[model samples]
Target chain A: MSTTRRVVIEPLTRVEGHGKVTIRLDSAGEVESARLHVVEFRGFERFIQGRPYWEMPVAVQRLCGICPVSHHLAAAKAMDGIVGVDELTPTAEKVRRLMHYGQIFQSHALHFFHLSSPDLLFGFDSDPATRNVIGVAGAFPELARQGILMRKYGQEVIQATAGKKVHGTGAIPGGVNRSLTSAERVELAADIPRQKRWAAEAVAIARDYTLENLAFATEFAAFPSNHLGLVRPDGTFDLYDGVLRAVDESGEKILNDVEAGRYADVLVEEVRPWSYMKFPFLRELGPHKGWYRVGPLARLAVCERIATPEAEAARVQFDEAMGGRPGTMSLAYHWARMIETLSAIEEIEQLLDDPDIEGDDLVRKGERRPESVGVIEAPRGTLFHHYVVADDDTVMRANLIVSTTSNNEPMNRAVESVAKKFLTGTEITEGLLNHVEVAIRAYDPCLSCATHALGKMPLVIEIQDAGGRTLAEGKRNS
Target chain B: MSESFTFYIDGVPVEAAPGMTILDAAQAAGIWIPRLCWHEELEPFGGCRVCTVKMNGRSCAACTQPAEPESVVENDSVALREWRKALVELLFAEGNHFCMACEKSGSCELQALAYRLGIAAPRFEHRWQAREVDASHADVLIDRNRCILCARCVRASRDLDGKNVFGFTGRGPERRVAVNSDARLRDTDLDVSDRAVDICPVGAIIRKGVGFTVPIGARRYDGAPIGSDVESANDELESANEHTEGGAAATVRQEE
Candidate 1:
């Protein structure tokens, strides 16, 4: 007699966009393989066709409301190539970089303090009813308020610099439209010290909780995987502008200082029948060995130093405490996220102090070209917006490789690793299932940005027998 | 004429001055009647029919109808709101009104009306009509896809600027706004400072030098819905005038 089973976690909660987890169990009730499936698709690429290249920046920003700046800047950078502007003016460069930093801070604050902290502080097995940001607010009101305020400050910067927090139209091809005003500068700078303090406290909290769980840190959702990020030519962390960098699991550099536009030469996307999300891998290593992670943890692992002084100090401590090599633990992503937030705040302060940030020469004009590519480090990971335009400058083809899609293969691996370690029997418990979610959450995947879904995410989990009969199920929201 | 004529919209009584259209009188009474092609500065065109209201049990275009004495006007009924929403959806489906990409997004009256009506998705199938963008002008671009045939530009050119540089061509689905010259905008007398350039109710007419000068969040319609002040009598003109024509895209930045 043979026995087989399957487990599914549908509409995973506390994450952007829709997703499901499926685990196959062998006849002996042992784990076979697990997969994280992205279920929704918005054909942004197909619809973006025929739009003028000048419109790409504004249009692509609508891909995800949460990370519109990432898309906005990336598309603008690609548009820079189309207009034949190899480098932006010094003022334009600073303004765009400031906008990018603001986005990273807000998005990371949202994920860490609001989404991930509930599980880290309350324990994953805690009641699903009280295990959310509301629960966090009930327990630690000040922390919750700080998180909201931090996010607000970031939004205010985006509004001042780019135009709006959600889909600001400040960025354009070649350069930005306007520079920061003195009044706006002073207003944003006034809150800088307070924001830096909050970021520091958040980082301290992440360090403590993440360091406490060594076994889970090293094992759960943690596996040997390649890492990808962007770094300045001098080997420092850069979120807004830099060359592509890739490293293997051992922290050895595989590719360094590669132009972001040439991403196709180094990375290739693999499509699986089961999901709309494409798994991107390194061209030389193939899918299995090429699977790598991109984001906070990967960024921390790939960069030698962070530019900001305070964030650099935090990085040193994180490296010393979380094992010297970059890929020591997976949960360290939380710590990296906090550090990145701190760096973003510090960068904001730095940009404000510089007099060139108010320069009136905001735009640069150049000869038009037929095709170009834009790449930037989104809060999640590296984002690419490629466009081919006609002589009339209308878009002919568009290809986008978002951060979450690039991490699809490794996200699946993390889910599989967690399932195999925690789930053993035919029957599944809530605690074990939460472990799977925790593993996935460690990466802070934004499925909404990944698949470009248009609806709110409602998470669900189900366990079934080999015959596809439902045996057990759990749901958060329909 | 001494006694103001009274009308009720959504059961609220409103007074109208003599010779005032129902739409204009409704604005004076702080009642919002959704409209297109009815700029306060320009003569009413009533081409789009977005401000359709039921007057004494019969449908009428509010912008073109004079407010009569003791008139019962129904403007905010559920059926009318749905009708306006459907019309906006049809206009959206009929054109490539990609709000995400359009330079006139926040300030676009059509997009603002759609947002005001809470239109998440259109009920009609998108025609994906192929349209032409004439960028031959030294400083103006005419993208026909975003036009809703409001004719504000043509009137502005003829009456305000006296350039007579714009006209309508074709009919029905094939009908479109066109430059007066056979060649392009460059051949016509239209300049960056022309009244016709900034009077467009949609992204159809935009200045070349400025695409995103005001940024998305700080644009005229970002915070308040279109005509929020005119209909509400709140006077948001102070904030609205700060960024109206200073930026690159010198299109319609004020509510008409």
Candidate 2:
């Protein structure tokens, strides 16, 4: 008789939201298949229905604490369309851009220094008790301090532009509500040199770590997939606002320069039975072959060049390190994320120098539209917010595709790749499970944003044979 | 003209005209007694009870109670403070006051009053009851979810605008601001310029398209607590009175 067994890793850690991995093995103890299950559901899209259209920008910020600014800006952009304002005043646009860059810089800094550094500094198989930000601080005190300060500087920038740190009312429909005062500009500019230096140092650290672990990093959950992001009309990197672009594994444009409003025409979301998250794929390529990757790795692959000098140079070095090919390594996400952080700092410096950011002409309005879409490159991936407003000014319908939701398929693929490569026996060991978590962390998935759910679930792992008798079990809450 | 009388509130003598309510007398003397349903331009309804004070050891709504000669009234006692705080808390629990996203967050009288009362969160169980929103009006929106049954709009429309566009419909917890028309603010003759449109102490009645226009920090009560203007005015008046009294006493001594 053929015998099969299953291993379940419940409540995956070191990532945002609640998720679990189930690995099934064949009769010979060979890994058969793996699936990542998102256990929570919020129905946030349904909750926003019937609310006033103007409230969307602030209301949607409740989606995720880690990326509230992303939702705020995305919903604001969509509402900008509802009010019929195609082009914002220079001051308004620059202020919004400054807020976006601050968000990306701070979010990246937090993920690297607080969340992912533990794995890189201590090996994946290291003891769980000593593999966290606290451990990193204890050993690498100066680096850890730099991380905290960098995150703080970025948050200060956000506070100045967005009004407060959380659920800011800065980006309103039509245009931004306020602009940076001269004093605010001066204060933020004072630390630009220091921020730039730290950002560059971060890039070097990620680059060195990836290059040194070339053999393991290259094949860890690595696969060929399409990349997607937003780019300026001139094909340079743009995070806040731009036309949508997608490139295949070989760096060939599959969808080029599509307006955000026309995204539904080229991309469609597919629902699977096992997970609450939706899988978005390119329409022309079909779901089977159209699953793509997003976020820092994808942005680095899709953009032609970085606009900032220091980041542009780092991008060149990255491309050379990859042998002038499209980067498919999941571990390289850390390196790509640091490069974007440097680019955001450089952009912040330029914005502070421009006097337009302090101008009083902050809002403009035109003919109103009934339907609109807003797309932005959130730190994790491309985020989409679409809304239909009724004549009474209430939202008729709302559909949000958060960054983590866009990376659902890729995350599953990553987990499967790691599980197949690491599982050696019926017993699920801690070090082996960490390998699976490390792959998922590379994507920086925000399950809360994806599922729109509240609260956390305790971690539990169980291994069972075909008869359902438990062979091994482990549990954790932190 | 009738003769005025004097009364002591919290040990401070306040002068009042014949037929003036305690709240009116306090306001005329530049003292803020914190009333919600009593607008200077409209008649006092005394519905909110946020201005309840002890008059001669009896609890009375300051906005409606007549000022009596030599009457002792306690306005800011510990018991009164706790009573007022509980009233405010009940008001918060009775409505879906989502202050975080409310357009009137910084300027709402209810929110400002809560801040002044030092009530961070409501103690009562929140009644998340379903409320109707009337957005059919071209220039006005009535989001009843935020209504505290203040009756400011009801009086403003009936007494000030002479349109009588608003009135109350239900009793107790069911009470809500209702338009004169069968349904919706648009069906009524209420105009965007009517006093009723701006009379709502909360966000229940708002002019459409004007919400959240003023940045947060620049809103009405962002810099100071709700009745600080009245308190500061009282301070200036008392100082001027002291100076005048000192000069008059010096003159009398020289004449003697």
TM-score, per-candidate, Cα-based: 0.83, 0.94
Residue pair clashes in candidate 2 = none
Candidate 1 C-alpha lDDT tens digits along A270-290: 988999899899998988788
Evaluate fnat for each of the predicted models and list the values in order.
0.60, 0.30
Candidate 2 C-alpha lDDT tens digits along A259-286: 8779899999999998888899999999
Query: How big is the positional error of residue A328 in model 2, measured in Å on the Cα after superposition?
Result: 1.1
> Interface RMSD of candidate 2?
1.2
Tens-place lDDT digits, model 2, residues B1-256: 9889999888889999888999988887876787778788888788889899999999999999999999999987778878988998898898998887788887888887877766766699999988988889888888999998888888888888998998889888898889998888889999999998898888988887665667767787767667666766788654543432223323332221
Instruction: List A-chain TM-scores for all predictions.
Output: 0.97, 0.97
Go through the candidates in order and give each one's DockQ: 0.40, 0.41
- Poorest 10 consecutive residues of model 2 chain A by lDDT? A454-463
Model 1 TM-score, 2 decimals? 0.83
Residue B211 Cα positional deviation in candidate 1, in Å, after optimal superposition = 2.1
